[model samples]
Target: MATIQEIKIDLEEKSMRTLLSAGTNKDCKIVAEGDSWFSYPVVKDIVDHLRQMGYAIKRHSKPGDTLENMVYGTDFGIATQVQRANNYGPISLKETLRSVKNLKPKFVLFSAGGNDVVGSELAQYLNHKRSGLPLFRENFFRDSVNGHIKSAITAFLEQVWQVDSGIHVIMHGYDYAIPSGLQYELAGIRFAGPWVLPAFARKAITTRTEQNRIIRQLVDIFNELLISLSNTYPNFHHIDLRGRFPNEAQWHNEIHLRKEGFEQVAKLFHQKMVEILNYNPVA
Candidate 1:
């Protein structure tokens, strides 16, 4: 496996035309964007694997960015908070646009919006009746969450299509996350999340079994939304990762994966990319 440093060298040395070339010196220019999922070693492994197969890559993923920031603007006050947990700085939609215009990639790999729904928005979906509050608010999905996500995705893609309608946008629906409140220790600080797990406990959704169900419901909603968008947009392709990793061992923390875990998921992404692009560098 090549280090991120080595991958950086490849990204810098490759040109857009050469990256798009195929059959002789086979290569494809891929713009990788999104969340900590892509910022981690999982995406690193994916890029390295693609490089070994002769694909040139340029990654613009930010470790703690959400779809809002990536498309709208940076308003997440916690942007500076999790620096130690995942080190890449914020990259806004404007910055992403700048790259798209400059690089003219064949495909844009995006992974985001998980943070938006995972944090405070999750509580709205829960049945808080055990706390003497009302049951699940039926209007919450339509009035708040769904429209917000749909609009963000629509606008994000609209902007990308405007840049170049030829660019195929690749995105994935995250696999279900356990409400385990698992923490990973790095540099003496313990970073554990989905964050909603602890939030669930605070709000009296105490049972692990119940927490898991609620979390799964939330994951399903988001994944369904992605699928719907794929159906709506011609250039957009969605990869459903719902059942890709069934074992709990795949999740390092509540929201992240271990190295081998990332490798497994990366292979899935690679397979889907090859299928959509119809150009297999490995072959």
Candidate 2:
């Protein structure tokens, strides 16, 4: 068996043809694309844990990517372009679909929409505290959820099925996060995030209790949208992770999870994969 490091391929660094020609096990091959949760720099992320569990993953993932950008094959803005240029970013979904058609992996793992809803985009959905209105601007929020997030994902799924109808897609709704103003740091350098707190601060929503409440509402709605997609599409599997990481220790920052937390989340994906593939590991 190959080591976990050997089993995982960065699609940005190497092509899918290279991965396939390297004698990767076809039965366990997986294509993964998404944001920081799957591609966090210098840390073992969900895709890394999955590789440890014996799956060969060809990953096209970059931190801070949005679903719309992935679907439309474009970077979100100047900031995203700069980040991609620096990081050697993931390819667009259209390019990924071409890979899918050739590789024909049994499963595809997608992690997106978090960047679309949170980060700098979050303030658009928030109402001013002085307005005495609902915490979220309902119409705008719903439009983003349905028109933007769902539409992009739906397009991706349809494109995947066009390549191979047998390919299943496993997606996750991110766990409820604490907006305690925590940012991920490494070696005393701030790498990414403080994703949620800035929006709360901008809206003058300060109390931890209120922050938690608002985040919970956002997570719930997002998960509900994913659940609806699962119900509608037989091949789409939605992993509801809300409240799964209840403790602050499970989280590394405002959005990403700790190593152990990610391992547990990967187990959920593994279980679903087992059921879908009727997989039995070699003893």
Candidate 3:
């Protein structure tokens, strides 16, 4: 088995053309796109673990990407703008689809929607405690998840099918996160997150129990949505990661897991991949 550093290809640092010329077997090639779960800067993430399992992964994920931007955003001048602002280049799912067409990878791993649900836009979905309304504006939350996120996912999958109908699309519902108010920091520099806590504070829902309940409900709903969406596509597979990291010790921060936890999650992904490849045996 190749080490993570040997198998993982950061797409930003290397061109797709160069990657193709490196003589990797297309059957073991994987294109991973989405948010920090796939590209966490502070620690080894799921993609790193998958690479150690022998997949040659071309990663196009960034730390704070949203499903909408990833699927619909263009490459033209957007990468420059995003790189200037975020210090990392933009993730273009269109470019990823093109890679899929060229590389003809057997599987595409997508990790998204977490940013869409818990990012800066989270406040929009919350109702103030003073309003005496539901914690979440249920209708708005449902509409955004189903209308925007789901639509973006569907669009990406449609493009993937066009590129290669036999390509398997693998997605994971992130495990339930603890809104512990712990922001991700590295070397005394705060990078990202405490994503859910501040929103809960602003809404005046400050109790730890209440925060846990709300986060669990949100994650559950998101996972259920993904599971339902997976059912509609013959080549799409959804990995249910709920309850996988049941302890606070497994989580590194609000939205990410510790390295060992991520490795465990990667094993689940590997298991699914093995099952698919064993049954189909990608030629």
Candidate 4:
């Protein structure tokens, strides 16, 4: 658990990109990388708060580094003797340990959801779409959708923990927001709505009927799997961010969080940290 002593924050929101002010936290470290809805603002906000507490912050993209020997010496299995470099060029565990130990983050907060809906197929879509393959839909196969998400998430968590098990890993799940509004045509091909629907409405559809059905099913399945994962993983905990703050609590983008909505999420997250990580804003 983290104390007012010092810390670091990693912002992982892949839905929207943002650049958070790295103000100051000589004792704490703040790591924020924004891309998709799963990145930035969300992560930076946390880092900003911790930094304000007199902690030094390390801002960087995912798969950051920490050198061996210098780390907290937790032997948390975070170090994969084999140097594995994530997208942002090459890095070593020794450097990662040094960075993390420097920031002294009590726990690691991983915020991601929504993007998986579109992300599940992003790679294939990119490749397929490039050649005009046309065989690309954000959510293609419902059956294996989560199996896809499961594999990706498991791999990601493995790397995160590998960096440092002593660092509590908080895996945030979807339902951080709810059906503030339907993502799009609820009826899939039919476009569920009174009247024969409006023109331009077709554009609001979720690809095709099969695609929509598969997407919805997969989202539900994925959340279920997430719940199970949380329960199974000792350090993993699911914050009950389900339901709505109010009818208007939803973002116009079907799944994104509105400003007020995000506020609610921030509060819940903060409270969770206070209770689980012994965290508090510096007075």
Q: Where is the poorest 10-residue window by lDDT in model 4?
A: 63-72
Which candidate wins on TM-score?
Answer: 2
- What Cα-based lDDT does every candidate model obtain? 0.69, 0.80, 0.80, 0.41
Of the two candidates 1 and 4, the one with more favorable lDDT, higher being better, is 1
Candidate 1 lDDT, 1-283, residue by residue in tens: 9766667466546634455455333226677778777775323444445555556666677666778777776553334566533323334776777777877777788888777766545676666647675434446754455787888888889988899898888888887776667755555576534566766866787877767666676777888888888988888988787876667877776777676666666677678768876777556
lDDT of 2: 0.80
lDDT of 2 by residue, 48-158 (tens): 887766676778788888887788766433456566543223357866787687677888999998988766688888888888998777777877788778888898899
Q: Flag the better candidate by TM-score, 1 or 4.
A: 1
TM-score of 2: 0.86
The parts of candidate 3 lying over 4 Å away from their true place are 1-24, 74-91, 279-283
lDDT of 2 at 95: 67
Collision count of model 1: 0
Name the lDDT of candidate 3.
0.80
Model 4 residue 181 CA deviation in Å = 11
The TM-score values for the models, in the order shown, are 0.80, 0.86, 0.85, 0.50
CA lDDT, candidate 4, residue 266:
51
**Per-residue lDDT value at 258 in model 2:** 87
